[model samples]
Target chain A: MDTASVTEQPVLAVIPDDGVRIVTVGLAVAIGVAYGILHWLNKRSSEESRVGAIIRHHWQPGAWILGILLVTLALPKYFTIVAITALSLLCFREFSRTTGVFREKTICAVATLGILLLNFAAIDNYSRLFFAGGALTVALLTVCTIPFDKPKGYIQRTALGTMGFLLFGYSLGYVSLLCNTPHSRLLILFLLVAVTLNDMLVFLFSAVGPKSWLLPHTSLGRTRIGALGALVVTTVLTCFSGMVLFDGTPLAALVPLLILGVGISVLGQLGDLLVAAIKRDVGIPETRPNSPNRGGLLERFDSLILVAPAYVHFLSLMLGPIGSDLPQRVITGGGP
Target chain B: MNDWDMQPAKDLHLTGIERSRSYVREAGLSESLIRWCWLCGLRNWFCRWNGLKIEGLENLPSEPPYVLIANHASHLDALVMASIVPRQHRDRMFALAAADVFFENPLTAAFAASVVNALPVWRKGNQQVGLKQMRERLQDEKSIYILFPEGARTRDGNLLPFKPGIGMLLAETGTPILPCYLNGTFESLPAHQKFPSRHPITVTVGQSIDSKQFQNRKAGWVELANTLKETIQEMSGKPAPEGLG
Candidate 1:
């Protein structure tokens, strides 16, 4: 008998699969189908009616839905940061372009570059100190808006400047928090999916429901039916997504998240309305002579700014701190 | 060419100077190049420099066979007009220039040819040749003729009497005329200064007037000329000339 035991086979360990890969693929397909259907419906609706006329009459609720969908689809993680940051810059640039805020409106171009740097800071979870600095810079800008003689103009500029900072700086800071969280990539995806669903539902509701003026004075005026529909849809989607992604979360924990989603959606709509009101008050035409129609940047991103801080606050409350080891179920209202 | 022009119409069997078609062709080429350059460089600069207060630019036509009649106060008036007219229509436009001034120097003459597309006119002498050339240019469907009907810069920076030549050209062509009022050019580059000073200028374009309305009226060339002067004066918020009713 050979001492080497040539017939003996080496033992190999069997790897058990967690089934995450399958679920991710399924989620992707579902999102793709939903987007395709929505796109087709939007196209069909536009063909049936004049888009401009429809928008002028009832745009707010639809805009809110569209904005939420865009934010949700973006995910706001490291990979999606570039896209989100680009949008943030565009929104701010458009706001400045339309409002004619800076003395040399060209300065907005440079400020957009600075925003990219801010986005980087946000992603690394480097320091809250940088965000604090940004807040201080905004305050200084507001002070600079003070007029030598006209107090009214001073106050107006200060308000406008402060709003710009809140929208561009503070709101955008949440994206950094998203990047820094443990399993941030997964959480961002969940948020994006939930928000997108919320946006779509809101849009559908607004389109079909009875028209009632939510804000009669502002350009982003919405109907009571539209608002109610948005809240219902957002809550349902948030709760549903929370259940599906997180296995151990309690129903009681989810109520706050649902409320937060509804509140953010409503506030976002109000921000859009505020921007439109500003343009209307200023009497700046949506289009300039020999130029294409660009309704101004501030008008475009009004809602995003309003919702960003609230989103950040909600995340902080749920997750404790951005870089902590809190499980997804706990952070997203899925766990007890 | 000079010898050929000296021969009498009877001997040559010619009917007047074969109305130099070359002048129109030359005008077209010169206007195009100058207009292109000005559009590329000077327009944006002028807009920035003056803060470009344009009141009624939309009223002007995109294509032109119309007369652009404006108040002339300084040499800078032409520059301002060139800078202000929409870039699209610049190439087809011509400004009437005094032969004694712009055409005298080689550099000035070349500039006048390329950029201004200047139609040189003798202010005093025989009006027949100048008037004939102007009328022919205006008659063309492709050309836009600009004339400072006051004939010369105003001494007091107020508009002078309307020259009869403008009325004669208008009567012959029956083209719509656009009245333009230029303010602050005199301060920017006053009549007496050689170098232009930095001053903001405003170029206001008034509504276009149809020549058909005045076509058959008893208001002969002189009366028509006075009417034009009055129209421009009213648009500019200045008083009409003293003696004209």
Candidate 2:
């Protein structure tokens, strides 16, 4: 609960850092069980069984993505920053491609540079630079196309560029900053597992209640059971995981832990709905429906988009400012 | 004010070689960067090493949705025109390249698609389908196409007959076509020679011809192609031989 204690990290904290060892072990075991279930589901998934059909359709790709996250987390801390940077880039790429904003190379390049600088700022523990990145990027995006002198489609392109940078570049930048914290490796794993479980649990528990649509317009699949499942599963997972991840902090308290769990699940669902709304608005079909192909990376991590920022803020609220204890601006070299 | 104004890139669903060879491919920032840098370096090389010179630059259109039709005798022709493209129009310029040659493999396909910003015209496939798609892209994207209406590169130092492919792209369209004559490219990089040799090349861009005057019919396309071919011949200061149309 004290700022000093939050900053105090053991010098020898290596990859699969003390607390993350548990998460890694859980993921390693889950990988095998997931594949086993997928193999079984593939053989027996008929139209007759709705549960089996749903599991068969999504579990393989979901497990594969989680497996990749596990591998990425088990690497050195610097690699976590690299992975986050790549995630931001890919997300921007998909967003730009989907919205026809990629044609505005000036805006896209500024956004791309902003995303890189965000990760750089986070890596150097330069909170000032990191915090300034979003506004600076939006400013650049606004003025980037002025030289072209063509005012037609100006509003559409600038708005798209601003939104894309804020979501994929700026918001996702928080994940890396979270990794720069004292117990970053564990935090990353905890957030990843919690959000993944929330999404998964919601779907799995949807078979329980009389399936009625929660937001029929935004999404056809989000049901009352799914919403309740998200609330309960994410809350419990957060409360349990917070015990270890926030071992010495106020976040480990019963009320705060439960709140963190609920916040994460709620934000996670909102993130998912945001992407669904984007796809619908952009007029792209839900391509994975009735198709055997794996879902796009955009679809897989859609929930993490919003949850990442909220989780980081939750940590900051409870454990003091992340990266505040470390020497700041290691790259730019000013702040202490 | 347009409804659903945020349409995705035309090539969003395509991947790998399919994306590279597809007619609907749109150049992204990566491709634009590659083509811009590619053209910049090539411009220097052609200007310095090949002694390239240009005239009648005034005839070049202020914007795109225009065609740059030139004689094809060497690989240097496309490379030269590609290098000479204005910086503002770099990403918008696409050359109609031979699918059998440039798009034969991944490496070449990438070069043709990104560096050259080319659209593959399969010599054997449905010409109408590809032409229709390219025309739509040219209009929708406001593209500038570098076309060699001679169809294929000539082996000897003589110009080939004008083909109807150019007509297919321009027929009934309001887009303007600029007839350009490129001299000494055949000597620099002839059909038999894979690499270009040092040679002074003079490029002459003539006045733009509005294709709105031509009908969208087959006969109109042929007449338009002939008119542009003759314009280039006159610019080249060489009359077509009795046999060559």
Candidate maximizing TM-score: 2
Model 2, docking class: acceptable
True contacts kept of each: 0.00, 0.59
Assess the local accuracy of residue B88 in candidate 2 as a C-alpha lDDT between 0 and 100. Answer: 90
> Model 2 compared with the native: what TM-score?
0.89
Error of 2 at B142 (Å): 2.9
What fraction of native interface contacts is shared by candidate 1? 0.00
lDDT of 2 by residue, B80-171 (tens): 88777789988788999999999999999987887788898888878888888999988988899999998898876667888888888888
Work out the iRMS of candidate 2: 2.7
lDDT, candidate 1, A142-259, per-residue tens: 5543434434445444554456545775576565556655445555554544444444444455555666666655533346676677677666655554444443322225776576
What are the per-residue Cα lDDT tens digits for candidate 2 across A1-336?
Answer: 454654575321322355556754564354345445445554565654555544543454445545665677768767888888887888888889888999888888999999998999888988878888878888988998999997778899999999988898888899889877656776787777777777766665565567797887776556888888779866875676566655654655899988888888898888888987887787665544354433456677778889898888877786677777666777788666
Which residue pairs collide in model 2, if any?
A: none
List the global CA lDDT of all models. Answer: 0.57, 0.79
CA lDDT of A328 in candidate 2?
76
Please give the DockQ score of every candidate, comma-separated: 0.02, 0.49
Model 2 chain A: weakest 10-residue lDDT segment is A9-18
Task: Score candidate 1 by TM-score against the native.
Answer: 0.45
